[model samples]
Target: MPSDVDSTADEQSNGYWFRRGLAGIISAPAFILMASFVGFGGLAREAGWSAGEAAFITGFIWALPSQVVFIGSVAAGASFGAIIIAVALSAVRLLPMTVALMPILRDPKRPGWVYYPASHFIAITAWVVSMMRLPDVPRGGRLAFFLGFGMSLTVCNVAVTLLSHQLAGTVSPVIAAALVFLTPMYFLVALWSAARMRADYLALITGLVLGPVFHHVDPEFDILWAGILGGTLAFGLHKIMERWS
Candidate 1:
């Protein structure tokens, strides 16, 4: 029922947002992500993976932790089944991120199936940036913007991984290792900056304080328990404060 002019305007709006999203690669988070992947590429090469293999993993898994787990497991001679389990467990953390972002990116008029592919790109970098930026975008074009941003990051990082794999020895091992920490450091800062609720602050701080303790207690399951306990404590405190107020 819309006129041609109206349809054209809508297209233009979508294109504009998409371009803006693609431009996100020039931002700090994007740079940090790519730098971290340079570390990953070096690690992959050290682990004896081919450039093609490293690029494939980056393009498909698209999750640094999982990719690292895969490379480490292979290098350690882990069984195929064990490697699969390790990678899947490492990636479990992304589920909450994807769940939180779905409502913001979902468009009522679009079919739900479209989001499945979109969800594949929901790494910490994409999720954090989208959560911070998508609220300002028009609801109709949020998906377009996210797709542009997410897809561009994936493509760019994969290329970086491949090139880094080829040029692995050029970077010192210690420096490459330090670079790998940048993504998580950036994630923490970005999460803190984007948090709007007291509960959010509580969860982050509690997680930060407890993470080391849990790591000492059980290095294998530290992240899982720290997240669970931190989140539970934060929620309880928030509820109690609400009641008292």
Candidate 2:
């Protein structure tokens, strides 16, 4: 349907694609992300964050993991420098995501500075959706579509965070915690659905196997080490298999 639409005169208009992208909010991933942020709002309240602070973090950071690390660190009375380091470490994963996404969204006619703000929207949800959807869109309209989807999602979630913060006390801790798991579940399922290569499957499986092992070894940096080691091993194995083939 997108390919059919792209072949028409609407292909030339950014506004058309942008408005179409706005429809992403109605999708499953969007709902999952909103639910996760509701959980985040409850977590923030339990951590003693103000509603304004929670909303600000949601708007600016936009990465749920980083927001969690930030609030967790602050609540635990970590030093300012330590909080910054922890959050930055948690968010470093986004750099590669942005790099992977830029080729699809970049318009050579536009200046590079335009991508800087767009980069802020490069969380897991936006990146996953854009990677799947942008190839079908005309190159000229990809940025507009992404901006429409990402900006709208971010705005809506910010409001959700604020509202959830106000109603945080009403939600039982167990349910709120369960809500937070929905995003990762969606992410795993989406990745599986989108996988096209053996290497992709290998990487995912390796990460899954290593995650708990690394957690048992060192809880503080489990995710970081698991991801790095698992991804590197998968990549190396893929290369070896390719050479043998």
Per-residue alpha-carbon lDDT of candidate 1 for residues 1-245, written as tens digits (9 for 90 to 100)? 21122233454588888888999999988997888888788778778888998899999999887887777667766678767776776688688788888888877767999998878889988988999888777777788899889999999999999888777667676766665555466557766885777888898899889988987996555555776788889989988988999
* lDDT (Cα, 0-100) at 159 in candidate 2: 95
The TM-score leader among the candidates is 2
Q: For model 1, what is the C-alpha lDDT against the true structure?
A: 0.80
**In model 2, where is the ten-residue run with the lowest total lDDT?**
1-10
Q: What is the C-alpha lDDT of each candidate?
A: 0.80, 0.81
Cα deviation in Å at residue 11, candidate 2? 8.0
Measured by lDDT, the strongest candidate is 2
lDDT of 1 at 150: 92
Stretches of model 2 off by over 4 angstroms after superposition: 1-12, 171-245
Off by over 4 Å in 1: 1-12, 171-245
